[model samples]
Target: MTRFDAATADGRRELFADAIRAHDERDSAFLTIEAAGNGANAGNDAGSGSESTPWVQFADGTLNLDCTDDELDRLKSLLDEFPSFTVDDLTTPEDVDGTNVRVVARTDDERVGEFVDRVFQRVYNRPDGYRAWVTVV
Candidate 1:
């Protein structure tokens, strides 16, 4: 678990930004905070027939799929102005196989590490501290 303490807002913001950047690099995707309905969902198709086969589909939820590195850094800085920051108690596995990984970002240290692990699992199928069949991804 990585640990870091922030005594001021600026320090917290910087730490948060650094954490976000690290996460982006590991995940190969950027993070952004956009409006709820301004994003597109990558849907999955369940049939090879025509559009009248009652294809089962579902919304994958909204996300900022096109966030720039600088944008993500800015958001991290903004988030630091809240209260405290820490990124500890994070675990990363060595292998992943397409499963749901849970990211628990409580303090600055834990949040950053967990966020990075989760994003990496989501985008690049990487594993964090402990590998599991259900949360490997």
Candidate 2:
């Protein structure tokens, strides 16, 4: 499949976030999309599951739906129109300049794991790889 990258840093972030929201929207459990903290920012985890928990923050620094999967393929297909959607990164998550959207709704452990994964994905990955991510099925 063809891979797509956002035109600008902000666009890249938003593209990733869109893929996330699209995939997450597949599940009925995902009910809401909220903002979160990052970088030097103090974050606003208002609509969350429990205290001190992590969440699925998207690229562009905002938005990831929750409340939760079958439609994952369908939403992924939508990326075809974007010209930048890639299969690799969608499975994984990235964070640059505090753009990853908050990932709430899941267990605290899962949230934290996801958070760390995003950081590592961007940190370890090369050049624009920072915008790309690697994940397990």
Candidate 3:
């Protein structure tokens, strides 16, 4: 898998353009958009979950979403509105500029895909927004 950073509006445009191209060519895959957080490196301390950082694990969820510190409260509030969704992990990188969150939406079963588009729209529409990349699942 490869990553294309959409840190700017132009970058976002280019990233989507590439995704469209890939889709048009019929090589569709998974895409992830999350907090870039001032380019900070979320390093890990040697511990039980030391193998990978929380953000990485969170991104591996059924529906991946994230936001900056400025939007954390609102994000949490949005999640609260839907009991089917529960925050699995919330990671704040030491000495970093923001937080990364992971949520899982499941009631009787994993009812997630239906909520992704709505959740992602709210996240990326924020003024401080988040980040994104594409992976060939």
User: Highest TM-score: which candidate?
Assistant: 3
Candidate maximizing lDDT:
3
User: Of the candidates numbered 1 and 3, which has the greater lDDT value?
Assistant: 3
What is candidate 3's lDDT per residue for 27-118, written digit by digit as tens? 44443333233223311121123222112212223344445765677677777777877887778878776776767645421234224423
Candidate 1 to native Cα RMSD, angstroms: 17.5
lDDT string for model 1 (44-117, tens) is 22122242111100011111222234433443453354233332222233463222222223444344433333
Over 4 Å off in model 3, which ranges? 1-64, 107-111, 126-134
Which residue window of length 10 is worst by lDDT in model 3?
42-51
Q: 66-88, model 2: which lDDT tens digit per residue?
A: 21132233333433432332333
Candidate 2 Cα RMSD after full superposition onto the native fold (Å):
16.3
Looking at model 3, residue 12 earns an lDDT score of 48
lDDT of each: 0.29, 0.31, 0.45
Which residue runs does candidate 2 get wrong by more than 4 Å? 1-4, 28-122, 128-137
- TM-score for predicted model 3 compared with the true structure: 0.45
- Predicted structure 1, TM vs. truth: 0.21
RMSD of 3: 10.3
